[model samples]
Target: MAAYESAIQSRVDCIEIDVSRSSDEVLFTLHGRQGFTTDIRKHKF
Candidate 1:
Protein backbone atom coordinates (compact mmCIF):
# COMPACT_ATOMS: atom_id res chain seq x y z
CA MET A 1 0.00 0.00 0.00
CA ALA A 2 2.88 2.33 0.74
CA ALA A 3 4.26 1.75 -2.72
CA TYR A 4 1.05 2.93 -4.30
CA GLU A 5 0.79 5.89 -1.96
CA SER A 6 4.36 6.88 -2.72
CA ALA A 7 3.69 6.65 -6.41
CA ILE A 8 0.79 9.01 -6.03
CA GLN A 9 2.75 11.35 -3.78
CA SER A 10 5.41 11.61 -6.48
CA ARG A 11 2.87 13.50 -8.62
CA VAL A 12 2.89 11.09 -11.49
CA ASP A 13 0.87 12.31 -14.42
CA CYS A 14 -0.16 8.88 -15.56
CA ILE A 15 -0.04 5.39 -14.14
CA GLU A 16 -0.29 2.01 -15.76
CA ILE A 17 -2.28 -0.65 -13.91
CA ASP A 18 -3.58 -3.90 -15.18
CA VAL A 19 -7.34 -4.04 -15.72
CA SER A 20 -9.76 -6.84 -16.28
CA ARG A 21 -13.41 -6.82 -17.30
CA SER A 22 -16.12 -8.77 -15.59
CA SER A 23 -19.09 -10.45 -17.15
CA ASP A 24 -21.21 -7.46 -16.18
CA GLU A 25 -18.87 -5.12 -18.05
CA VAL A 26 -17.11 -3.98 -14.92
CA LEU A 27 -13.45 -3.02 -14.87
CA PHE A 28 -11.04 -4.02 -12.13
CA THR A 29 -7.47 -2.96 -11.29
CA LEU A 30 -5.19 -5.81 -10.39
CA HIS A 31 -1.46 -5.95 -9.83
CA GLY A 32 -1.11 -9.54 -10.90
CA ARG A 33 -3.01 -12.78 -11.24
CA GLN A 34 -3.71 -13.16 -7.52
CA GLY A 35 -2.88 -9.74 -6.20
CA PHE A 36 -5.56 -7.05 -6.14
CA THR A 37 -5.13 -3.59 -4.74
CA THR A 38 -7.79 -1.02 -4.02
CA ASP A 39 -11.34 -1.45 -5.18
CA ILE A 40 -11.11 0.87 -8.13
CA ARG A 41 -13.40 -1.44 -10.02
CA LYS A 42 -16.44 -0.13 -8.18
CA HIS A 43 -15.68 3.43 -9.30
CA LYS A 44 -15.65 2.67 -12.98
CA PHE A 45 -18.26 4.29 -15.12
Candidate 2:
Protein backbone atom coordinates (compact mmCIF):
# COMPACT_ATOMS: atom_id res chain seq x y z
CA MET A 1 0.00 0.00 0.00
CA ALA A 2 1.13 3.60 -0.61
CA ALA A 3 0.95 4.40 3.11
CA TYR A 4 3.37 1.65 4.00
CA GLU A 5 5.64 2.77 1.21
CA SER A 6 5.55 6.36 2.43
CA ALA A 7 6.32 5.26 5.97
CA ILE A 8 9.26 3.25 4.75
CA GLN A 9 10.51 6.21 2.72
CA SER A 10 10.22 8.44 5.78
CA ARG A 11 12.31 5.99 7.83
CA VAL A 12 9.53 5.15 10.25
CA ASP A 13 10.40 2.44 12.74
CA CYS A 14 7.00 0.86 12.35
CA ILE A 15 3.68 1.41 10.68
CA GLU A 16 0.32 1.22 12.38
CA ILE A 17 -2.36 -0.96 10.83
CA ASP A 18 -5.63 0.33 12.10
CA VAL A 19 -7.67 -2.82 11.56
CA SER A 20 -11.38 -3.40 11.57
CA ARG A 21 -13.93 -5.82 10.23
CA SER A 22 -16.27 -5.52 7.30
CA SER A 23 -19.96 -6.42 7.36
CA ASP A 24 -19.06 -9.78 5.90
CA GLU A 25 -16.71 -10.43 8.86
CA VAL A 26 -13.46 -10.00 7.02
CA LEU A 27 -10.66 -8.05 8.66
CA PHE A 28 -9.23 -4.99 6.97
CA THR A 29 -6.67 -2.28 7.72
CA LEU A 30 -8.13 1.18 7.90
CA HIS A 31 -8.33 3.99 10.45
CA GLY A 32 -12.01 4.84 10.57
CA ARG A 33 -15.06 2.65 11.14
CA GLN A 34 -16.32 3.77 7.78
CA GLY A 35 -14.57 3.13 4.48
CA PHE A 36 -11.81 5.36 3.05
CA THR A 37 -12.33 9.14 3.44
CA THR A 38 -15.05 8.81 6.06
CA ASP A 39 -13.53 11.26 8.53
CA ILE A 40 -11.24 14.28 8.58
CA ARG A 41 -8.80 12.33 10.77
CA LYS A 42 -8.55 9.71 8.05
CA HIS A 43 -6.80 12.30 5.88
CA LYS A 44 -4.05 12.75 8.47
CA PHE A 45 -3.57 9.04 8.88
Candidate No. with top lDDT: 2
Q: Write the per-residue lDDT of candidate 1 for residues 1-45, one digit (tens) a residue.
A: 555567699997666677899999999876543556555557966
**List of clashing residue pairs for candidate 1:** none
Q: Give candidate 1's whole-model lDDT.
A: 0.70
**The 10-residue segment with the lowest total lDDT in model 2:** 31-40
The lDDT per prediction is 0.70, 0.71
Find the candidate with the highest TM-score and give its number.
2
lDDT of 1 at 14: 61
Model 2, residue 45: distance off in Å is 20
Could you give candidate 2's per-residue lDDT for residues 1-45 as a string of tens digits? 776777799997777777888999999886434565444445765
**TM-score of every model versus the real structure:** 0.40, 0.54
* Candidate 2 error regions (>4 Å): 31-45
Cα deviation at 26, candidate 2, in Å, is: 0.6
